[model samples]
Target: MKTFTKKLTFYMGKGHIVRDITADIQAVVNESKIKEGQVTVQAGRSVCIISTIEYEPGCLSDLEKALEKIAPRNDYYEHSKRWNDENGHAHIRSTIVGPSQTFVIMNGKLCLEPWQQIIFGDYCPNEHPEWEVFVCVIGE
Candidate 1:
């Protein structure tokens, strides 16, 4: 079995941001030279998440709205009370969305539905928008 790992970083604006990372995961799979295997993509922080979602603008917008409804920012949370911060909703959103996703690699390519794209979503409302995603490909 062969394994390859890559760390990716990017900046996201305030509010909710979803960025597609399908190509990046494929790149790691290609580098690993694994014909059939599995790849895991994980977010490095609690305020961020990795999942599959439609990359279209409308779908992305709706996802953001749905998340807002699930964890409204204006609501009070014990997490914020403890830290004196305003991103309690970010934590809730990330927990619901999850922090990692695993995908199958077949024929040296990611096996995904045409419309299902891997996404790195940052729910933090902070000024420093840097986020990290780790990709690990394993198998032969």
Candidate 2:
């Protein structure tokens, strides 16, 4: 068995935003040279999420809207009261969306549907200079 690990960093703008990271995960898999394996992509921060989705404007907008409805930014949260910060909604969204995703690698390629793409979601209310993603590939 072989294992390959890589860390990806991104500077994200303020507000909730989603960015396609399928290519990055594939790049790591290619670099690992493992034909059959599993790749796990994890967000380094609790306020972020990693998942697969259709990388399109409509889907992106809908995702944001859904999250907003689930965890409204203007709603009062006990986290904000304890931390004295305005990112309570961010934490809630991240927790609901999760922080990592695992995908199968077959014949040195990611096993995903045509419309499925890995995405990184930053739900922080403020600009984040460095958001980190850790990719780990294991198998032969």
Candidate 3:
């Protein structure tokens, strides 16, 4: 099996920002030249999440609302008190959403539904000067 690994960097603004990264991951998979295998996309931080979603305004809004209901930023978090930081909710959201997603690579392309796109979410309450995403493609 062959493997290709790459790190994608982004300057992220304050909390609750989501970006579509399907094309970026697909580019990595294409560069790997792996006709059949798996591509794993991972966030480098605990406060970030990697998952699949429909890249659209309505869907994005819905996701935001849902996450808010699940983990309200205003809620009390012991982690915040311990760290003297206000990003406890961010960690919770990241844990729930997960930090990585693996997709099949078929014919040198990422196998995903037309509407399903990989997304990276920054949940930190503060701005991140640089956020890193790691992509690994492994296959024959």
Task: Specify the highest-lDDT model's number.
Answer: 3
lDDT for 72 in candidate 1 is 93
User: Please, what are the lDDT tens digits per residue for candidate 1 over residues 1-140?
Assistant: 77888888887767467889888888888888899989999999898889998799999999988998999988999998999878899999999989999999999999999999999988877755577888898898
For candidate 3, the 10 contiguous residues with the lowest summed lDDT are 10-19
Better of 1 and 2 by lDDT: 2
- lDDT, candidates in the order shown: 0.87, 0.92, 0.93
* Candidate 1 CA-lDDT value: 0.87
Best by TM-score: 3
- Flag clash pairs in model 2: none
| Residue 58, candidate 3: C-alpha displacement in angstroms | 0.7
Order of quality (lDDT): 3, 2, 1
lDDT assessment of candidate 3: 0.93
Listed per model in order, the count of residue pairs whose N, CA or C atoms clash below 3 Å is 0, 0, 0
At residue 125, candidate 3 shows an lDDT of 93
- Give lDDT tens digits, candidate 3, residues 1-140: 99999999988778789999999999888888899999999999999999999999999999999999999999999998999889999999999999999999888889999999999999999877889999999999
Instruction: Mark the regions of model 3 whose C-alpha exceeds 4 Å error after superposition.
Output: none
Give, for candidate 2, the lowest lDDT window spanning 10 residues: 9-18
Write down the TM-score of every candidate: 0.94, 0.97, 0.98
